[model samples]
Target: MTDDTGYEFFEHTADVGMRASGGSLAELFAHAARGLVALVAEDSAIRPAETRAVRLRAASVEALLRAWLSELLMWFDTDRFLPAEYALGAVSATALEGEVRGERFDPARHTYGTEVKGVTRHQFRVEQRDGGWTANVIFDV
Candidate 1:
């Protein structure tokens, strides 16, 4: 991440939001993942031990932002995997593919821990930027 006024993270009443600026759509999505994980744990501390596959569709960028964060949360709820790293394999006008890797949550390993209730729409936003796109998304933790 650079300091070109590229991205910023904001705290909301019940969730966290991030506004990312990049030259491409993939960069924005990847940064958003990084921002989301930053809310839960240090990005450097999270180690990838397993790989998972995910697919999603949304009518708009805002909806996609919600779907993206919710998908990450779903991995925690269903697979117990904490996503700390994201590698966006493909990105299209309306779709994306990637692998999110992280170690399974362990009581002993995770600190400052709080369960993420869900991804919410209270303060969600995603839109085009000067070069590409920027998204403001809120997630419940």
Candidate 2:
């Protein structure tokens, strides 16, 4: 996938890989989440008509990222939600609190993409470099 939001998808043997960078950890997380949503459905077709609250904590940044994406995937699996907008109120190395706005999937109005099964730890990483944050995540498709 290609986009101007500091995120990109890379070819993986049996899965999908995403790399996202941002000036802040919050932005990086948001970009990664967007990438995940885009993988499930055409992001342009998703609308911010509903909102959901998110609060997560982990022992480390990498774990936090995994939890964050996993939460989003859970929402999709349970409610067919596709988030289009993100409002991260607080973001730290091990905690994140935010709100995501989007609507449930509508097959007639949305183009379905890959069905992501889960976020994997293979080559997964979140780091701060050159005064910015970057994350690499792999999704089991």
Candidate 3:
């Protein structure tokens, strides 16, 4: 369940799942965004030439995780800004604030062969384990 970069990745029947541990909520959200970006593009290869602002609120940490991913998808749909890197200014059980950098999505520049239809509720899970946050997401890949 480890990718070539050594980040653990688990592929289920529908989508993929990964785990990242952080000392703070901001770091955890940042890492979670990184993991999601890796699912579509190479983290290092994604050019950081554009910036975007995002604000999201949820009822719980698990909902916040889904909201974060949904916001990324919205940015991709509207601006074509594929997220390469993300920095979280704040995060909590119900809210998140962050910025992501990436190149404008160009079919020539950024080739995402597989289409992610959308995030799904099936098997969706997020939890805190061992003093760290873990998110299990299933997308309609």
Q: Pick the candidate with the highest TM-score.
A: 2
Per-residue accuracy of model 1 over 78-102 as CA lDDT, tens digit each: 8667776677777766677877777
- For model 2, the superposed segments whose C-alpha errors exceed 4 Å read 1-3
Q: Total clashing residue pairs per candidate? A: 0, 0, 0
Who wins the lDDT comparison? 2
Extract clashing residue pairs from model 1: none
Q: By the lDDT metric, which is better: model 1 or model 2? A: 2
* Residue-by-residue lDDT tens digits, candidate 3, 89-135: 87889988778777876766565644555767876776666765556
Model 1, CA-based lDDT: 0.68
Rate residue 32 of model 3 by lDDT.
65
lDDT tens per residue, model 2, 35-99: 88888995557889999999999999999999999999999899999999999989999999989
Pairs clashing within candidate 3: none
TM-score of each candidate structure, all chains considered together: 0.79, 0.95, 0.80
Error of 2 at 129 (Å): 0.7
lDDT, candidate 2, at 64: 96
Q: lDDT of each model, Cα atoms only? A: 0.68, 0.90, 0.68
| CA error at residue 102 for candidate 1, angstroms | 2.0
